[model samples]
Target: MRELLTALLSQDPTIEVVGSATDPYQARQMIKQLLPDVITLDIEMPRMDGLSFLEKIMTLRPMPVVMVSSLTQQGAEATLNALELGAVDFFPKPKLDMKRGIEKRADELIHKIKTAAQAKVKTLEREQDTPLALNPLSNIKFSTTEKIIAIGASTGGVEALRVVIKNLPANSPAVLVTQHMPEKFTKTFAERLNKISAVSISEAKHGERVLPGHVYIAPGGKHLKLHRSGANYLCQLTDEEAVSGHKPSVDVLFRSTSEAAGKNAIGVILTGMGKDGAAGMLELREVGAKTFGQDEASCVVYGMPKAAYDIGAVEHQVSLNKITEAMLNACGAAKDRHIRV
Candidate 1:
């Protein structure tokens, strides 16, 4: 398995196969020696379970970790927990059937590893404790919105948002996104979104106003909140204390929207790990706002949305294929509300 994976990564110039191990004991020693930039882990290592060893690594010498696993339901749940414990993400391993499915999945595996390798490593250090710096918000400026849409996500959020946003109309409502990304990546993510979707998307500048036809991503290392002044909404980027174990926490964004936009805001929680946005989505619902969560069948990791659903945070559950239509329906300018939300 290690040799095959090594050859696979070597085939792609963007990926460098640094080290590989099938057992936790060998993996631990390899990590100590190679200190590779990114580590790919299998859930069922021979010497010890992957999760137990992963806990040790996280509590000891934290670094970027990605879990490679089967796509089974059990594997999915385990992989999601690993993310909550600070593994950056997970990619479903290629199926074992010799004549089936593997060819179609190899590119996805390669892409995920490349993305993980490029993930900001330093952010893992005290990442859960990092606060939102309020400095950027001082004396900032913003554009007002007729109605603001607040969205929060993590883990597989990038691709999920891509699927949903790609289907939205140019006249869609103003959007504020809080995806749990690192500092440099949010800009890249926003730029990527901007290119793939008709709506303008950019990294949030402190005090930037919420405007229809544009989307703002909360800076990865900061916290974003909505503040209202005379019927307009402003994005206030800050370094205040971490909320729900994430710097740009989804809960913080949702709660602030509940406070600032009230009934005019639509809160959506997409794919991710942990219980971060569960409470906030409910708060959005309580204020006569609409709340939506990504359904389990379509999630890369169903942790966040499931947490919200279990606690009554979501008023609607939609699959990846239908979420953008749902968002459009919620926005009221679209021709239909027939889509799920």
Candidate 2:
């Protein structure tokens, strides 16, 4: 696996394979000697597990590191923990015909590694418990029509989405999320959010009614779009080919929101590696949906939002913490609360 990754990455003109290590001790020695810009770490390493080593690195060196793990329940949980412990991103270790699998996903691997290299990593502290439920909005009046919130994220989304979604009020609009993630990981991500957020969150199922105070995460390997069904909007999932190089694409969700909900939709583009949602966000703006982007300083990787901002798709460029309030304001639910923008 190590040899394959080295060979694959070395093929990229912009990337170079530095020293490779067989163990944590060797890795530490190589890090000191080579001082490489980015590190691709395996979750199951000899001498020390990746999570423990990752925590130590974040505490001491605080550099960009990406996790390479299997795609399973345990792997998903450990990857999430690694993110919280300061991993910039994670890539699933190839399964079945190792060399071919690696070759097939070589572009994705290279992209993630490059993105990780550019990510601004802050020291991660254990998160404090947040209130599980919010006070019901008293002063806000809901229109007869439903308001929809469309949120897109990638690289640092696990933590960034946590900050934004957990801050939403109990009466917030129905949210449709397209976070770049793998199949099983999306379910686990939604479950994690449901525990910490005021609103209910689940992986979206085809033909399900999009309800208020709930978030629908686009299932991995599928496209999540919205359809108007009488008085309610419905979730529609498709196995269309990858859009913007993503299956559960942010562009697909935002485009559907613009067409279906129009002015009633709120589009948010958060931290990510590339410009997947930028064009779709512009379409949303053209259709009168309010759009917001996370500012560069607050993002782990500022690529996506910066693209949106540059293209005029984003109306407001706010910090990560202020995104929920901005969405609530767009939904007309942020009247009395003092929200910092």
lDDT of each: 0.74, 0.88
Per-residue lDDT over 99-133 for candidate 2, one digit per residue giving the tens place of the 0 to 100 score:
88778999989988888989999876777756554
Residue 237 CA error for candidate 2 (Å)?
0.3
The TM-score obtained by model 1 is: 0.60
Tens digits of per-residue lDDT, candidate 1, 168-229, equal 55566888999886565577667766765666889999877778778899987899898887
Kindly report which residue pairs in candidate 1 clash with one another.
132-238, 132-239, 132-240, 133-238, 133-239, 134-239, 142-209, 143-209
**Cα displacement (Å) at residue 60, model 1:** 34
Residue pairs clashing, model 2: none
Best lDDT goes to which candidate? Answer: 2
For model 1, give the 10-residue run with minimal summed lDDT: 129-138
* Candidate 1 Cα outliers beyond 4 Å, as residue runs: 1-145, 334-341
- Candidate 2 TM-score, true structure as reference: 0.93
RMSD in order of candidates: 16.7, 3.6
Give candidate 2's whole-model lDDT. 0.88
The best candidate in terms of TM-score = 2
